[model samples]
Target: MLKLKYYLSLIVWNLFVNTLGKSMFTPQSIRFLLYKMAGMRTASANIRSGCSFRGKNLVIEQGVFLNHNVFIDSWEKVLIQENTAIAFDVLICTSSHKIGGPFKRVGDSDRKPIVIGQGCWIGARATILPGVTIGDGCIIAAGSVVNKDCKAHTLYAGVPAKEIRPLENREVNANIK
Candidate 1:
């Protein structure tokens, strides 16, 4: 079947990437080409070494930067728009488990897409859960856990990633160190 073939090819490609592709000698353009060849939607974004992915449902737009050790489990589609910068050790997953009855805490698997709008900055160690659509010009602070949608032009930082405040361009420069 087509699905079987698709999965098999993806597996092989993942294996190849996880090994030799992570080497510094491997060019990022070659990685992008390999992903595209395997039917994944990707652009000329700079994906650093040690980054891992799952499935073919991924879209990395132009000017996006993914730092080292970023993990993307794309059970469903994950679209990172242009000019977005994802810091190191960020985990973006498209698969989760539903809460079930008392006997069985974790129920069936739930897969949903994640859309990161243009010009967003995801800070280091942030964990973006399934079905999260981050709006444009947003900043996710370090070590935050994003479990819901984020609004545009805002700063979010917390355990559950509450919106700290709306971002406004200020004209004052001060150094208080």
Candidate 2:
């Protein structure tokens, strides 16, 4: 069955590709090949070892580099556009539990997609919450917790991630290699 195959592939990826410490030394093409074989849509991506995700709702565009220990909990969908670089230990989640009395009692949770536009740079250890849309050429500061949508060509930082300043005349340099 389809579901059985999906689970088996997930197990293989986690065991063979994600857990091995030496998998980082493996060529990027092999890593991408394994991910694509597991049903993820990836193009020219360099996802380092120890990166973990569930399901097949991840779309990583061309020239995107995901550094080590990146965790994408894509219960919904996650779209990382071209030339984006997500740094180490970044957590991009697409699901969270609902708060309040009745919802908590019923174990209700919400799911929404996360979209990171082209030429964006997500700094180290940034936590992107559910339903966040980071615009093109934006720079997320290190250790920032982004709970809301971000604007293009700007820098965001801090706990809740406030816009620090607009990146004037620097959108051309925001493309990550």
Candidate 3:
């Protein structure tokens, strides 16, 4: 019975995603619609229109919102943890070219998982390169290019995303209050 269920699920998923290319609407619109309708979550989360997600290995947790025009390429597993917000036009990629030879074939490429830890905010236009992890509560500034792992509770900016400063709780509260 379980095997039958699994096979049925696989067939449904393939038909819905592959044969259809999920083409009932635009990719972003479809993602928003599906996430709102049937995507499970511990708390309500809003995914704005115009966010594009490809590949099937993606996971979005509770209270994780994907803002407008954000592009998430999930060829490998891309996990966005609870309370994380990916801002408008933020691009998260999980695939990279093979560097071994001059001409790189698609089959020779490398793919790795991208993990966005809980409570992290990836700002608008931030480009997170393949295989990078943004730790919990970290802030990725707008227009930055991140190709390295970011520490928890810190602010990272600039090309390649060097840590700028540790996040201060009192400072955050002051702004909120």
Candidate 4:
């Protein structure tokens, strides 16, 4: 009965709040309230309309912004720290199927935490896979696939997201304030 109620409410939220574009006009406080009701741990974050998140293991810190159409599949914990901005159409997933085993044959899956440190920017259409820890002040370029841990104050781009360069202290500090 509890599972049924939870799923029903989640469906209602998707239909009324996420798909109906309510966040575009709804006050930020109301939006945060709705998300909190849906079991997300959110601070003073701004989540734009058309964004969708699943599970109760999601945390959005103060000043975090999730742009339009962002999808978070939080099978495990997903933590977005303060002052981070995730651009449109980004996908952050914390679950994936196992490979080459009996469990894989039976469609078994694994989950891990995704932690995005403070003051980072995840560009549009970037995909963050399970168990990825993105350090503070990093920039992930658009269309990148991040499958591993990232360093602090770095710029990462391309498929599978190679480190482009270490961001200068000036560049890193500029967006912090």
Best by TM-score: 1
Please, what is the whole-model Cα lDDT of each candidate in the order they appear?
A: 0.87, 0.85, 0.76, 0.86
lDDT of 3 by residue, 46-117 (tens): 666555566767888878887777787889988899999889999999988775545544446689999999
Name the runs in model 3 displaced over 4 angstroms. Answer: 1-45, 103-107, 169-177
What TM-score does structure 4 among the candidates reach? 0.84
Quality of model 4 by C-alpha lDDT: 0.86
lDDT per residue, candidate 2, 1-177, as tens digits? 999997886787666445542276767767777666656778865788778776568888998999988999888999999999999999999988776585355457789999999999999999999999999999999999999999998899999999999986454547877
Per-candidate TM-score against the hidden true structure: 0.86, 0.84, 0.73, 0.84
Pairs clashing within candidate 3: none
- Ranking 1 against 3 by lDDT, winner: 1
Candidate 3 matches the true fold with a TM-score of 0.73
Candidate 1, which ten residues in sequence have the lowest lDDT sum? 168-177
Question: What tens digits encode model 4's per-residue C-alpha lDDT throughout 38-149?
Answer: 5567885488877877766888899999988899988799999999999999999999877666644645688999999999999999999999999999999999999999
Q: Residue 147's C-alpha lDDT in candidate 4?
A: 99
- Supply the global lDDT for candidate 2: 0.85
Poorly placed runs, candidate 4 (over 4 Å):
1-27, 100-106, 170-177
User: Which should have the higher TM-score, number 3 or number 4?
Assistant: 4
